[model samples]
Target: MVIQSGESSFGRDSVTRATSPFLPPPVTHRKDCMSAAVKRYRYLRRLFKFEQMDFEFALWQMMYLFVAPQKVYRNFHYRKETKSQFARDDPAFLVLLSFWLFVSSVGFTFVLGLGVYEFCKFLLYVIFVDCIGVGLCVATVLWYVSNKYFLKPNYRGQDVEWGYAFDVHLNAFFPPLIILHVLQLFFYHGLPILHRTQVLLYPLVPLFLTFIVSLASGWNIIRTIMDFYHYRV
Candidate 1:
């Protein structure tokens, strides 16, 4: 009888142990989930604010960078197409490149003539001009690539339309030149008072403008390329 009782007690304990694992415990608030949700909300809010600030800043900067100058040099000639099938053999871009190099060299020489007080001024001018020229050359190469591979069908009226690509290329190429010329006039002609702070800020304005324009243009190109790929697929 004692053995039977011991066996019965062991079986009951075993049954309780087995049931306890399967049964749900008393309800407890999950602090971890609540904390994670709060973190996610705060992160999203921060991201939204950042995006808004970026847009506002870019808009303000772009207006000062592009629009004000447009009023001054509205008559400037902008070359839209440097290469087409009819002009495939033309060396116009090469000539333009050579001309820019010569002009840049002359500018550098002038900058070199200035004494210590004006060295920074000259250096800033040269840097801005060179960056603009380099950007133009790069835009030309991208234009050619787009024309050859991406725009060919549109040119032939076969299927693809790359009008947007052409427009983007044009938009990307012109601003740098405009900014360069504006800065050149601003510094060389002494239109703006040459405070030390102004001198430093002046070059930065154009450089920043160039950077933003390039970024926007690159984004457009990438989107277009992706669209083309998607369409082809």
Candidate 2:
């Protein structure tokens, strides 16, 4: 009787092991992992605008802004119609490019090279001093001027979003900034210093051009906002 009982107990143990509830099926485990990965990928796509702007389109838009400002502006509307309102025209590429140009300009200023410490300091100054303070100050002025002057004539009592103003300002800055840096690379190095107080001539041209273009685009941008509010331009 004892031997028979032992054999029965062993059989029960084998059955339990074979059909354990804690052990997930192989196919189920793979599906769960794949689902998790897909979810993560979707989240990333939304956060970064990965699906909206591809590499070629991004390059074309930035270049097109100079040659055809009106066309570029129109493209923004097309994107809004097709994509969500939150989908922006410039995307992450331009923003990254702007920062790259700024840093490269600073680095190129030093003919030799930068040490680890100096490089770190330059980066900090670019972010905090140049980008945060100066960039914000310029954008704020653009926003204020557009709202005060242009929008009032067309769309009275409607306030323009700072985001729109900032985007326009940043994009306007890119071409001029690139031109200034190119001058810095070639001409600025060779020019003789006239006086301590006088501004460098090579960069002044591009800087002035940048300001004019920014102002004009700013007006157009305000018009866009007015149109968005259902007001006639």
Candidate 3:
């Protein structure tokens, strides 16, 4: 027998309950959907309130992503324990990521000595193509793949959340964003060994990201960088 009940999410109103041997789920499911909508509405309302966001924790997450990534994985476990959700409830990390994205782009503009027009183009590519475009495509694919093949049969009514999948992408992207876009600028002119290092580094990027840019997959970062190098030379 299934039980049916309606309770106001906004108030401590009484829940009127009824039970039947063959009650359909549509009615109860609607209440659940409405509750989720309320929570989502409240979350969006907090997005503009900077003081309410936990930027300190988000910044720690960014640093630990490189130093101790397992810690970041545990963060979700902790959230699941406390909040019953594997995805982040706060958007502070996302806000910090956007901040770093622009900061790194500005460094890239200066290090590459791009003109005003070129900088504008590069900024658009970074914002639209490199980050959002790639992130959305990768996150959607992984979300589908994980739910389709990776989920355990025992876990009913619990699959990979789309938001958690995107969070995984953000956590993974943060380190490379720092290394390639931020730290690389420091070595742009100072590194005399970069030319020699390419012979070794060229193979690493593609090899490390084979699932992403294997010869069978798509354009590889190392290959693109080499093409640019040859063009300049």
**Residue pairs with backbone atoms closer than 3 Å in model 1 (clashes):** none
Residues 38-95, model 1: lDDT tens digits: 5335534554353333333223323433556441122111111111111112122223
Model 2 per-residue lDDT tens digits across residues 1-233 = 11212223322333343346675432322322323345335535654675554545556556766776665565544433332221243355445655666666465647437776777776677656665567678878977887788775655735444555555666676677667654556655453655554464678899788769979877565666678889543
Model 2: CA > 4 A from native: 1-53, 79-90, 102-106, 109-112, 152-158, 191-233
What RMSD does model 3 have?
14.0
User: At residue 150, what lDDT does model 3 achieve?
Assistant: 87
Q: Considering lDDT, which of the candidate structures 1 and 3 is the better prediction for this target?
A: 3
- How close is every model to the real structure, measured as TM-score? 0.26, 0.49, 0.67
Clashing pairs in 3: none
Clashes of each: 0, 0, 0
What is the C-alpha lDDT profile of model 3 across 1-233, one tens digit per residue?
32112212211111112223344432423423323455457667877889988777787678778777776676676455434456677888888998898899889888888888988898889878888889889999999998998888888567777778878888888899999999988877866654666576688776677755565666576888899999999
Q: What shift in Å separates residue 147 of candidate 2 from its native position after superposition?
A: 3.5
Candidate 1 — which residues are off by over 4 angstroms?
A: 1-88, 114-186, 189-233
Off by over 4 Å in 3: 1-40, 190-233
Pairs that clash in candidate 2: none
